[model samples]
Target: MANENGEGEDIPVAANVLGTIGTILWCIQLVPQIWYNWRRKKTEGLPASMMLLWATCAVPLGIYLVLQNVNIPLQIQPQIFGALSYVTWGQILYYDHGYSRLKAIVVVLAASAISGGLEALFILTLRIPYRKGTTWPALFFGIIAAIMLTLGLIPPYFEIRKRHGRVIGINWFFLAIDTFGALFSLFSLAAQKSFDILGGVNYILVALLEFGIYGCHTVWRIRNRKLLREAKKSGRSVDELLEERELERQRQRELESSNGERFTGIDYDEEKSRPSTEAHSVDGGFVQEPAGWHRT
Candidate 1:
């Protein structure tokens, strides 16, 4: 193959093959998270900052990959990643933070526009005479993206710690898939005629972070299953145990409200004072009272 400077270079076929696999993996990496959020109808423990930073990082990454004349699949990979990340971020805002649908949509659009515009500006600026034939600009942006990716995992790590080692609201399968994708991307980078040092480091860090998350998730699941078994032994269903937990959480919120915590729009006192009503099991594994009725 011929380099951009018209010099002869041996491009490995394996590099392109691995890059294609990495591209495919990256494209679908977010699907599990998206599906998990949709099915759960919540994003409680997911970090919006992580998604936002990663999405922003992708703008520079895409520009760098394209400017370096990487394979077409690699060039397109970051765009897909950014778009999906924005969607995940929007889900967090809408479901976890209770943003209105219109507000979430506006925010996602604004972010996408800003990132895309910045990437375009960089692409144009890097095409100037002095920067045109050099790899410095691409390398600089790639390093920046790598740093952003490494830092993005910090919030999620803290979130897990704050939850007492419980991996709530995170989909382990998603993390596993993402880690594998990062591993494949590292292999792809290694097979290149000139390996991307920054990219390889970024993928390695991402894979390690994701694997750590998976480990935490496994431990959390084991703990939860043990608790569920204990509940069963006590003649209680898991749903009942979960409902108790929810009630406890609600009571804690009420206590906070009484102690001058911010208003949450719910009249906790009124709910508490309502007349007793029979609880009925619902298909979703929760207990509910009849409409116009309340539990004492």
Candidate 2:
């Protein structure tokens, strides 16, 4: 039961305990991302491919959620978590490149209009045919979904990375929360006396994937730090490291030119000092005393 706060006071203790645990995990997961993004102000080296893959995974899970329709206390299956996941993704986008409130309102209106148009074309005009269980439709939409998700993740990734030159400020706490949330989800599923339903399995899988993502990201960040250090030692900056290497070629050219000049100077002096055979004969040509040359 909630205390004097008057917020959700009378729920069962199990659900509350599960929710609390899940929430802690969610915070763990989210805090790192948010902290890195905010403090380091960078998202560079974060693979857009990874995020795209994640969103791809999310799509199938969302479909599964719809297909299984598992119910739990507090609607604790994928429905609540799934929707929350989308919201979190949206927040990521906003955190990176959010618009002003008024501008966001305009964008929302515009998006609504576009969606309305599409709905009209499909539902009202009946121009689009509805097909079930077709491979072609699945392939077409699958590619489209992949492209759209990739596109959505691209901007913020670039924006944050470009801004901070690294993914420093990202929140790690959020990741922890999410990881724990998955465990709680697994527990909750086990709590479901019915083993026949797919909800628990689905949540377990989701949690596993989320944990994998966090693990990979952590390793990636560590490796990236080493890479950056190496880059700096080699006299390169994050954005222009390659360019700096190209500039080093100019240094090489200058060094080669200087060396060539020294060698050429020595060769020229040697050639000039070579005595001509005619100098021994001294015929017809007035033999001037060999010009006294003094090495300076």
Candidate topping lDDT: 1
Q: List TM-scores for all candidates, in order.
A: 0.73, 0.39
Q: For residues 52-152, what per-residue lDDT tens digits would candidate 1 score against the true structure?
A: 98889898787777777655666777898899999999999999898998999999999999999999888887866324467777778878878887888
Give the clash count for model 2: 41
Evaluate model 2: give its TM-score.
0.39
Give a tens-digit lDDT track for model 2, residues 40-97.
5444444434343443433433332222222332223222333333333434444444
Model 1 global lDDT (CA atoms, 0 to 1):
0.77
RMSD of each: 16.9, 11.9
Model 1 stretches astray by more than 4 angstroms: 1-9, 192-194, 222-225, 231-296
TM-score: which candidate is best? Answer: 1
